[model samples]
Target: MLQIIVAMMLFFVMMFGIGFILNMLMKTTWFPIYLYLIVLLPLGIYYTWDDSMNFAQNMGAYTIVDYLPAITALAGAYISGTAIRSLRRGGYKMF
Candidate 1:
């Protein structure tokens, strides 16, 4: 519904902006994606995991509504990295 669309956009913009800033400050191309995959994802899953459900069942419980925002956020992180890489290739030293 409208809420899902809004959440997806919000997550995408949040990730993009944060990743952009982090890349600029840390001078790293893909760190934000790594951070998202390695840190944020695990924490989120762990926090939401159900003790009664098996791993597969728990994972399978996520619908398109639940996954869309995460997918968009990941896309945002990847795009930010590509943007920084292009900027570096274009000879912008600060980025």
Candidate 2:
């Protein structure tokens, strides 16, 4: 449980850091971040699978198939929130 929390926190921090940098360096459109995430997430999941498997084993019968989609949705939510903030801050033009 604790390990999972730590892993999740690390994942969020890393993703957000990257997103923040991109937002600073270029257009803050969620579209590109969305696409980047599609590529990055699978690699993240692959790297984290062992830890996830251990955590799941502790809980019983959790598969990557069962969890990946939910995690991806969570990632999307984070990116959306970041994009919304950037838009609100006038980083992006509405018109």
lDDT of each: 0.94, 0.57
Q: Model 1: how far is 31 from its true place, Å? A: 0.2
Q: What is the C-alpha lDDT profile of model 1 across 1-95, one tens digit per residue?
A: 99999999999999999999999999998999999999998888899899999999999988999889999999999999999999999999999
Clashes of 2: 0
Residue 52 in candidate 1, Cα distance off native in Å:
1.0
Write model 2 residue lDDT over 1-95, tens digit each, in one string: 66656666665566656665555556554643674557765665566566535765644554554464446545744675566576668755541
The model with the greatest lDDT is 1
| Model 2 error, position 23 (Å) | 1.5
Task: Write down the TM-score of every candidate.
Answer: 0.95, 0.49
Spell out the clash pairs found in candidate 2.
Answer: none
Mark the regions of model 2 whose C-alpha exceeds 4 Å error after superposition: 43-84, 87-95
TM-score of 2: 0.49
lDDT (Cα) of model 2: 0.57
Give candidate 2's root-mean-square deviation (CA, Å): 7.0
Top TM-score: which candidate number? 1
